[model samples]
Target chain A: MTDVAVIGFAQAPNVRRTDGTTNGVEMLVPVFQQVLGQTGLAKEQVGFWCSGSSDYLAGRAFSFVSAVDAIGAFPPVMESHVEMDGAWALYEAWVKILTGEASTALAYGFGKSSAGLLRRVLALQLDPYVVAPLWPDSVSIAALQARLGIEAGRWTEEQMAQVAVRSRSAAAGNPAAQLSGTVDVAELLSRPYIADPLRAHDCAPITDGAAAVVLAAGDVAREHCARPAWITGFEHRIDSGSLGARDLLAAPSAAAAGRAAGAGTVDTAELHSPFTHQEILLRGELGLGEQVTVNPSGGPLSGNPMFAAGLARIGSAAAEIMAGRAGRALGHATSGPALQQNLVCVMEAR
Target chain B: MTAPLSAPLEISFDYTRSLGPVLAKFMTALADRRILGSRGSDGRVHVPPAEFDPVSFAPPAELIEVGPEGTVLTWSWTDHPVDGQPLDRPFAWALIRLDGADTGMLHAVDGGSAGQMRTGMRVRPRWAAQTSGQITDIECFEPATQPARQSAAEPAAAAAGQAVAAGQAVAGQVADGAADGAEPVTMIITPVRLGYQHTASTEESRYLRALQDGKIIGQRCPACQKVYVPPRGACPTDGVPTTTDVELPDHGIVTTFCVVNVPFQGQRVATPYVAASILLDGADIAFQHLILGCAPDEVRMGMRVRAVWRPPEDWGTTSENIDHFEPTGEPDAPYESYAHHL
Candidate 1:
């Protein structure tokens, strides 16, 4: 079987909003070119394409279909889509390569989360019969989880503020981050709650952006980029969708996926935690050692572009290896209410 | 203009769903002014019952009665509420571990302020004036001592089944109106509404701007050099933004088309009208538009047509500027002229 590696990756600048259409053509086109340029490959060489996005976020149906314009999809391309974060889309691309269906593949995810009331739109992901009818917004839902963690002594409001401070300080170096600046944890704690126990800094800013990654199997991967980040292990898992039934403080799904993917011994981790407390919870669930440097790209709290943010974490992790910043790294993504779903990708410089 | 054109867009839909057996039992209990929880594989009961045990991956072993009272495991204060929430005013959203259930259920706590709500606070259901099988059956939770309106739960003890059906009353599936079933929460209508500030791309904005001024403009892609009307954000073949504006004649050939017989929501055109893909003389791609002033059968591939503009006063930054297309009476272009587009 051919071993697939992420040969190149690129992301658009995360911003509160873009003047472009929800189809994400403006954001995705440049990133596609950037990734292709990094690999010294042309768009025509991309054999399989997949994407992740939500029609609810775009305020339009089949929004990803229009996004293919950025791929230069003439003569038609074998493509697929997931109504999930882009990291899941990358899994599909990797499968295409490993199965010998394609030698080169590209996976991308994009969203104009700013196009709609993001918290309200997210309600659609809940159980259609019970919870969604109540329309409990996403922030309040996260706050509920955050409070659970805080009350249970698993994490605290002060510590959650520290996560924001560190993420912002780390993000100052990432030009693509939407929010980045050094702040005293004291100042963050002093801020009033946007949703009780969750401050403005604790929740990721709603952003509009896109990202794309290029993958190649074996020799083709070596031909494009010099130090490819090989996929040592990749796995994903989901918890039951019952928000009331699952333990709010525990991300059993993340832990399960981490254990399955052999998520040990990575020096750097790019986690997709939209809420600050979630970062703390994920650190424990994924069992990252205290010494492990997490979210050096500042993670989603600094700049979360919804559908694209998860895939960007994977790209950010691969970049650490490709840039020789780390010998091994892990990328994690989440979906649904309160980290109900999770995917983990572990990569290493081989 | 430095800023692209943008407008408020509102999209809405109603989704109807049927409840499975496990949820049906739960809803029936709610209607009877009682709460039901399912015992999971772990032998713990879950309120707002789990249809299947998460740990066991099997249907719950049994159902049990749970709470009208519970303790707040954790809660968050919402200072300002959005539409459709359990409460419009300030409230605390809490995970309440109802009495007799091991797992917690989520609902709003109608506390006066944040200072009043705390973890481990005891609360009780503020029953609605009218009971419904829906989650809203227990309006919202309030501090245990306060009674939430008089219990309208037992509207008529004599009419047990009728009262239960009334508890299930909702828009699409009016309880009394449903096909007879003692415990079928078979229909749920979810109304989804979203608002957006929809913006046109720089290339598309230019095309639309020209359309407003009564002209047809297109852009040529620098890489592929294809002339595209309602110019694309990226050239579909090269993935490069289209550059170089080109003006084009409205008269063009219909490369392909379909005669509409089915009617859908928001469709203005009459049935049997032709929806055609017009390939303009200077453009390489086809744009969808409608054909009128000719029978649907009269519309054909390779036929020449011209835009029949709405009265000039009716024009704006909209494709509606062209009311429809009409036969131009000019000779149909050779099929080769548009075979590439088709």
Candidate 2:
């Protein structure tokens, strides 16, 4: 199999809202230019293009198609899209390289989450027949999981608050982050609950952003990047969709993806955990010990741009290795309620 | 450097779903104020019954009557409820384990306050005054201490108890209306509505603003040099924004057209009108617009046409400023002039 590596990555600033359209053309254009410029690759040189976004987020059908305009996709280009997070699109790009169908690929994900009442719109992701009819907002569903862990003695509110404090402090270094700076855990605890057991600091802010990553196989990667983050393992797994049937405290899917992707020995890790408790929960499930540096970019709790945040996790983790700060790193992404679906990518400097 | 144009956008639709045998039976039972669970191959029952056994991936073997009362396994309080939730006031969303079921079901509990909610609190269904074949038939769960609402199915409670003891499938029995030759629910309709602030791209915004002044503006792509009317976020071929603005005359030739005899909802024009692709002079792309002031058959390819604007006083930032196009009373251009546009 051909070895694929991440050669370049770029992202838009995470903001509460963007004046641009939901199609993401405005947000995506600059990131595409930046990523391509970093790799010194021209638009026509990219062999395959894939993206992740949701029409439901845009409140318009076929929204992703209009995003191609940002690519200056003139003439025609090989392209595909997934109604999932951009991390999944990266997974597809990796497969395209491995199959020898393309020597280089560009994967992107974007969302204008502020276009709608994000939590209410997210209810549509639930079981359409039964649960969605009741319209349980996303925050309430996540709080249900947080409380389960709390009552089970698996994690506490203070511990969850500590995760928030650490994430915001880490994000102070990330210029693209929407929320950053020092915060007191005690102060966070004193805040009123948006959903009982969940303070505002516990949840990820609704953000509008876009991200792009360039991947190349073998010689093409070496030609562009002096120190490429070579992908050692890539895998994803999903659990039961029936929320009531599964054990919410245990994310079997994350564990499975972690084990398959050889995540145990990474020196650095980036996790897409939208809520504070989830970061703690994922830390246990992925079996990352205290030595593993986590969320150097502050993770999703700082600024989660829906579909784009997951891809940005992979980008951030790969940067640690590409920058020679880490010998190996792991990037994890999640979808569905209570971490029902998960993807893990382990990269190494070679 | 001004922001793009934006407006409120609401999308709504009713999705009618057909429930298979298992859910059909389940929903039918809800109409009678009874809760049902599906018995999995593992012998564990799933509330709001699973369409298929989780372990075996086979259709459920049977549906069993669970409980009108249960214990909250976990919960979170919603201080201010959003639209479409089961309750309007402050309520706790809980995972409840009904009596005789191994798994939990998600629903709301009207516990009155966060202080009243706990991990193991007992609760019972607060049935809707008018039962429908839907999950909302049980308005929400409340403290079991509250008196259960009396229903017409009171006489069958003893029989239901006997069936539970024997672990028998009671969907056919408890859904009494079905036993008396009434139809089981075969379908359900769920209405979904979402609102968003729809925004137009900067380039498109410029074109729309120009239209309000009765001007047709096009932009020349820096890379391809193709002139695009109404502009574009990026020139599709060059992957770059069209920078140089070009003003075009309203008069253009119809590259192609279709006579719209069929009528659609919300259509402003009557049937048999011409909808043509107008390729304005000095522009590379064609835009769709109505061609009128002539018979349907008289509307031909390469026909010369000019914009028919609505009164200047009525103009806004909208394409509707152009009421329609009419014949320019000039000779039609040769087919060669628009062959490439088609």
Candidate 3:
């Protein structure tokens, strides 16, 4: 296995809706070119390519198939796709690198959530025969988890409000963030709930976006960037899909992934928590310390692109290391209902 | 400049699942309006029973009726709904263990609102308007008014195993264990009917409109000099757009061939038919199409085929316009001529 490092990362400005098709070719083509250009690596140079997206999100089956044209896969490329976030796509790419299949790889994820009601499409992830028949909206499901945590005295509504306040404030500087501005936690807390416990601001806005990350082998990494964000550890796991079978307030998958990835200490961390209370839930689950600065790019609350948000989190975390803003960073992604699946990637400047 | 177009689209298909033995019995019991669970040797009554015992890897023998009513072990409120769901309105989704069952079954509960639902609330089955040997036989579960039955046994006809259908027999063998020398069996013909909003890419939409005019258009890749039938943003080889417009004829030849004798899922043609890849003379790639107007066995490699179009009145902006390929009856080219193109 070769020591792979993130050489380049690029993303489109997250928006509430993009006129472009849900296939994400229009949104992703430019970002693919941007990342390749930044690393001076051509698309043909990428030995292996993998993508993460979902059929439900695009309101169609085999949605990723059409995106093949974006790659110009005529002769065909060694590629596979996961019905998951782009973060998992990165995990597959890393696994391919570890197995010595490819030296340079590209991972991407994209989604246009506004094509249909975002929350409604997500319900399809539940057990198809059983729970899926009820059609639970994601916000209501998250609220149920949030209410349990609040009643159990794990966290307060004010604290949840504080997380949103800080995330948006931090996002003010990020040009690509969909929602960003300075606001007091008390003023935000005064707003009415959209799903009882969670305010509109507490939830991630529906966004259309795409993200691309380029990884290279040790020698290729050294040649591409002055400070390559070497992936020190990468691990992921999926818990049971049954919402009733597992604890919602605590993400066992995130904790398992974090411990496996050695996500103990980091100067900066990017967490894909579309809901504010989830940020608190994940922090306690991963056992991150107070020293770790979470969501330096304002995170998913500012603009959450369903399939691409997790990959954007990893890309942003690597960006911090590349820009010399942080020495070590942790990137986390989640999937399924209430963080049923998770992936943690730890990177450091080398 | 005009109002955006929208229409109601429904993608629904009754998937015929071969349940092997365990699930088949379960479905049969459902048809009889009874809930049955199979008990493994370890004494676990699994609802919609497992085909193979998780622990002993043996098929279950004991069948029991756990309950028509069960408590919700855990539940989530559904405020939004998607197409094809049991309820098109808000409801509580839950995992309920029937009175006699060990593992819980997932279904919708008619909680109506978040305030009416709790994790431990009990619910009963709401059978469908008409019964079918499908999961939809049970519409959903609703709040139950009373507890479940406690009988150990009830008067009923003895259960008997029936001869597996030929189609299901192959599926069962494949399910229980991998089989060798299995002639490509047509186990299933799943007609997938997924309706997407099919928004074409900007360039492709333009080409589709041009196709409506009965013209063949090709986009030329500057680097490779290959003209693509449909314009692409990235050339498959160079990963760059095919920048120029070039016209190509609709005629092509058979590059390589495969006789799809074995019937499979979503087959549009009859059994023992030949589905081959035809390379349009000017195009670099070959696509699948049916070889028609000839016996299935008579279709040969390098057999020249041409697009037999439907009547002009039946034309549409789709590849379906070319109904099927018919034998051009030209002399067969030598095998070595197009073997490499394969």
Candidate 4:
């Protein structure tokens, strides 16, 4: 099998809102240039291109197609798209490389989540017959999960607040991050609840951003990067869509994906947890010890750009390995409600 | 310098979904002011009935009555409610476990305030004024006034048999109604609406701004030199911005066209009118516009047309500045002139 590795990664500055169109051409253009420049690879040299985005977020159909403009896709290029996060697009690119169909691939994800009422729009993802008809907004749904974990003794509100504090402080180093600063855990708790059991700081801000990662196989990877982050394992798993049926405290899908992707040994981890409690939940589910540095890039609690944030987790993790900051790293992405679906990618420096 | 042009964009549609057998039984029961649960392979009853047995992968064997009242397993308070929620006032969204069911069901609770909501509080259905075969038939849950009765096992068993028989009868009515045309409710229509502030690209904003001044402006792509009107954020072919501005003539040739003989909702133009792809001289792409002032049958590819402006007082930041296009009495351009555009 061809060994795939991440050679380049770049992301747009995470912001509360962007003046750019929903097609993401404005946010994507600079990031695409940055990633290509980092790898010293020409646009034509990319063998495959894939992206992840949503029409629901944009309030229009076929929204992802316009993003192809950033690729200068003239002369026709091999491309595909997923209505999921860019992390899943990277998963597809990995398979494309393994299939020997493409030696170099670029995966990207973007979202102008600010274009619409984000939490309300997410209700469409629930079961149409039963839950969605009630129009349960996303924050209330996460709050239900948070309370479950709190009452079950799996985690506490103070611990959840601590996660937020750490994330914001860590984000101070991430120039592209939307939120950053030192804050007291007591101060975060003193804040009023937007959704009871959840405060404004506990929730990820509505953000507009895009991210791209370049993947290459074997010698193609080495030629472009001085030290490529070799993908040792990549896997994704999903739990039942029925929110009430599964145990919210235990993310079996994240656990299963972690086990399959060999996430146990990573020295650093980046998790896509939109809500603060979710970061705590994922840490337990993935079995990362106290020693394993988590969310060094501040994670999604600081700046979650919807579809792109999940992909950015993978890019951030691989970057740790590529920059020689860590020997092994794990990047995790999640979708659906309350971490119902999860993807884990483990990368290591050779 | 200025922020790109933006406007409110609202999209809405009714999504109709057909419920299969399991949900058909579930919803029909709701119409009668009763809650139903499906028995799984593990002898557990799933509320809002699981269509397929989670473990056995088999369709529900029977749906039993679970709750008109239940216990809240976990609850969260919503300080403010958004549109389309069960209540405009603040409420508690809870996962409730009914008396006879092993699993919980998600719904809203009219708990008044966060202080009143607790993890194990008892609640009951607040039926809608009108009962329809829909989930909203039981509007929202309210705090139960009385403690749930601890009826003996024997009476509960008898009640389960009666509920199962009632469910089968509803299913039977649906089966028979298929022949008689008095169809039971087997489908649900959910009207979904989302609003967005749709922002145009910087290049597009520039073009719209030019239209306000009675000018047709395009940008030339630096890589491919293709002139795009209402300029693109990036050239579709070159993946680069079209930096150089190019002013296009109002007169152009029709690259392609279609005669609208059939009318649609909200259509402004009359039937038998021509909608043409106008390839302005010096522009690489054709934009769709109404081709008027000529017989529909006379509108042809390669025909020369000129823009007809609305009153100058009516001009704004809109393409509507050009009311429509009319045939120019000039000779038709050669086929090769626009064959590449098509």
Taking the tens digit of each residue's C-alpha lDDT, what string does model 3 give over B1-342?
222233334454533444555555565556456777778788887776666665697887767777888887656565554444456567665667899877767666767787887767888887654443344456677888644322112111001011111111113343321223322221221212233443555555555555666666668788888777776655667656677876656667776656776877888888777788886667765678888899888888888888887887877666677778988888877778667668
Interface DockQ of each model: 0.54, 0.52, 0.20, 0.51
- Pairs that collide in candidate 2 are A72-B239, A73-B236, A74-B236, A74-B237
Q: Write the per-residue lDDT of candidate 4 for residues B1-342, one digit (tens) a residue.
A: 998899999888767777788887677777677888999999988988998999999998888888878999998899777667776678999999988988889998888799988899999987765445667776778889644333223321122122111111223345521322334667766667778999988999999999999999999999888899869988888787788999999989999999999989999988999999999999999999999998999998999999999999999999999999999989999998889999
The candidate maximizing DockQ is 1
Alpha-carbon shift of residue A130 in model 4 (angstroms): 0.9
lDDT of 1 by residue, A156-230 (tens): 888998999999999999999999998998888888999998999999999999988888999999999899999
| lDDT (tens digit, per residue) of candidate 2 on A1-350 | 79999989899999999998898988988999999999999988899999999999999999999899888775789899999999999999999989889999999999999999999998899998778878899999999999999989999999999999999999999989999999998899999999989999999999999999899999999999989999999999999998999999999999999999999989999999999999989999999999999999999989999899999999999888888898999989899888989999999999
**Candidates 1 and 2: which is better by DockQ?**
1
Clashes of 4: 1
Put down candidate 3 lDDT per residue, A1-350, tens digits, no spaces: 57999999999889987766778887877888899999998777888899999887787679898776677676778888988899989989988988998999999999988777677667667654334434456876787777777877898889998998899999998888999998888898888777756788878998999998999989988998888999998999998665654567678889999998888878899999988889998988888889899999999998898889999999999999999999999999988878888999999996
Give all candidate RMSDs, comma-separated. Answer: 4.1, 5.4, 7.7, 5.8
- List model 2 lDDT by residue over B1-342, tens digit each: 978889999888778777777887778788777889999999999998999899999988889999988999999999988777777678999999999998889999988899988888899988765555677667788989767644324222221111112111222333432523445676777777778999988888989999999999899999888899989887877667778999999989999999999989899988989999999999999999999899989998888999999999999989999999999989999998889888
After TM-score superposition, the amount by which residue B9's alpha carbon in candidate 3 deviates from its true location, in angstroms, is 6.0
Residue A7 of candidate 1: its Cα lDDT? 90
Query: What C-alpha lDDT, on a 0 to 100 scale, does residue B17 get in candidate 2?
Result: 78
Greater DockQ among 2 and 3 belongs to: 2
The TM-scores, one per candidate, come to 0.94, 0.95, 0.77, 0.94
Error of 1 at B340 (Å): 1.7
